[model samples]
Target chain A: MPTVELRFAALNGHVRTARMIATAVSRCAGVPAGAADEIKLAVTEACARAVRVNRRHAPQSPVHVALTETPDSFTITVADRGQSGDEVAPGPDGGLVTASTLLDLEPDSAAPPWWSEPAEEESEADGGFPPGLGLALIEGLVDEVQISRGADGVGTIVAMTWHTGPAVAPSDSIL
Target chain B: MDLSLTTRQEGNHTVVVVGGEIDVYTAPKLREQLIDLVSGGSYHLVVDMEGVEFLDSTGLGVLVGGLKRVRAHDGSLHLVCTQERILKIFRITGLTKVFPIHSSVEDALAAHE
Candidate 1:
C-alpha cells in the first residue's frame, strides 16, 4: 500500500501533528480511538525528542515522519538528521530519565539529577535527547518499536508497528 | 481548548462552564480560571464537563485542588460529567466519590436550589 509521509521542523507546536498521523493510521488499521491516541502520543514524543536533538545540533534541521499501512498492520517512522560536533557522552541523565518516567518505564526507580550523574563516553550516536520516554511509549503502545542508527551516523530512525490492526480496548483498567 | 464561565444569583450558586479537553496541556488553563473564581469570592462552583473530550491526571489535580480551595471558603464544587470516557477516568481514579457528578448542566445548575 502507498505510505503516508510528512516532513516538518521539530517543534512543540507540531506535536499535535502526530495525533493526526495516528488517526490516519488507526483509521486505516481499524484500531480503537484510545489506541489511536496512544499511538499518536508515542509518535509525538519520539518526534519531539528527535527535534530537540536536532535543534541542539543542527539547529535548523527538519524531522521526517512516514506512516505505512498494510492489510495486517501499520508502521510509523520518525527520523532526523543527526548532530555533528564534540559528541556529548550519554548516560543515565535527566532528559532521558524524564522521558522514561513520562513513558512509565524505569519501574519504581527515579533517575538521579543529571548534574550529579557521571557521563559515559559517546559512541557514533545520532542526534536525540535523552529521556528515552519516547522509546518506552513506543514500546508500550505498539507491538514493536525499532531504532535505526543510520550507517553514516548522521541520523536516527524510530519505527513503531501496530500489529493487532488497531482495535484497542475502549476502557483500560487504569482508565 | 475552550472554557466558558458564568455566575448567577440563584438563591446561592456560582457556576463555571468548562468545555474542552482537560489534559496536561490544558489543565493549567483550568487552574488559572479556578484560582480567579475563588479569589474573586465566587463560591458554590459548578463545573460542566459535558463537552470535555478527555480528562487526565493533571486535569484531576486541578479539580481536586479547586475542590479543596472552594471548600476552604465554606463553599462547594459540583461537576457535570456526561461523557462516558471522562467518567471512566474519574471512576477509575475514585474521584466519583470525591466530587458530586451529575448527568447534565441543568441538573447541576439546579443543584444550587
Candidate 2:
C-alpha cells in the first residue's frame, strides 16, 4: 500500500486541488467511481477546515494531507498547524468523534423561519455568511472519522476513512 | 474560478444557473450574487445547480444564507438540483426540509408561480 502526502498553502484556492488529488488517489486505490464524489466532498471539507484554522493561527504553515491506501480502506488525514484553545475543537484527549456527536449540527437551527433568530450571532460572525456544515457532511460521506491532536501536539488532525468496496449508495447511512 | 454563475429571469423568478464546483473558494461568489438579488428586490430565487460538479459545507452555508436573506422579504429560495451526489449533501445537512428542491429549472419556476 503506497502513501502520498501533499502540502499546500493554507488557502481556500488550494483546497480544490487537494480534493482533486485525493479523489484521484482514491480511485487508484480501488475506490469505486460512484464513491469518488464522496471522497471529493470529504476532502474538500477537511482541507477547508485546515485552511481556516491555518489562516487564523498559523498563517505561515501549510495544510498537510496524507492519502493512504490500505487493504480494507482508503484514509485521508487532514492536519492543520493551528494551535489549540479553539472553541469548536474536539477535546485535547483527541477523542473519536462519532457521527451521532457531529449530528448535533442542529439542522433545525439552519432551518427556515427560525434560522434568522438564534443563528443570527453565528451569521454575524461571518458578516451574514451561513454557518458551516463541514464535519457533519464528512460524517455522512465517510465510513469512519477520527479527530485528534497532531503527533507533535501542535495542531488538529481529522482522519476520514472509507471502506474500499463496490460502492456506498448515496442514501446509505455512513453512520 | 471553480464556480460559474449566470442569472436569468423567468416569470417573476430569478433563476441563478450555477456550474462547476462550489467549495470554500467559490462559495463567496454565489453568496454575493444571492445577497445582491435579495437586496435588489429579486426575492423568488430559483438556483439551478444542475451543472454543479461539486459542493461542500461552504456551498451549503451560502445556500442557507441566501434562503435567510430572501425569507426576510417574505421570499422563497427554491433549488433546482438533480445530482444525487449534491442532493445527498442537502439531505445530510437536513437542508432538504429547509429548501424546496426541484428536479429541473422549469419545475422550480413552475412551483414559484
For TM-score, the strongest prediction is 2
Best candidate, lDDT: 2
Model 1: colliding residue pairs: A31-A166, A95-A131, A96-A130, A96-A131, A99-A133
* Tens-place lDDT digits, model 1, residues A1-175: 4377888876644645665666675677665445555565567656766766677776677888888878667788877787432222223552122233432233454664221222222310221123453454355456676667755888777777876543534535222
Scored by DockQ, the top model is: 2
- CA lDDT of each prediction against the hidden true structure: 0.60, 0.76
State how far residue A55 of model 1 sits from its true place (Å): 11
Fnat values, one per model, are 0.00, 0.39
Give per-residue CA lDDT, model 1, range B1-112, as digits (tens): 4444444544466666777655444556787787788888877888877776655444665776777678777778899877666675555434565688988767877765
Q: Give the CA lDDT, 0 to 100, for residue A170 in model 2.
A: 43
lDDT of 1 at A71: 68
Model 2, stretches more than 4 Å misplaced?
A85-114, A118-132, A165-175
Candidate 1 chain B weakest lDDT stretch, 10 residues: B1-10
Compose the digit string of candidate 2's lDDT tens values, residues B11-67. 788999999988888888888898889879998999999899888777877787787
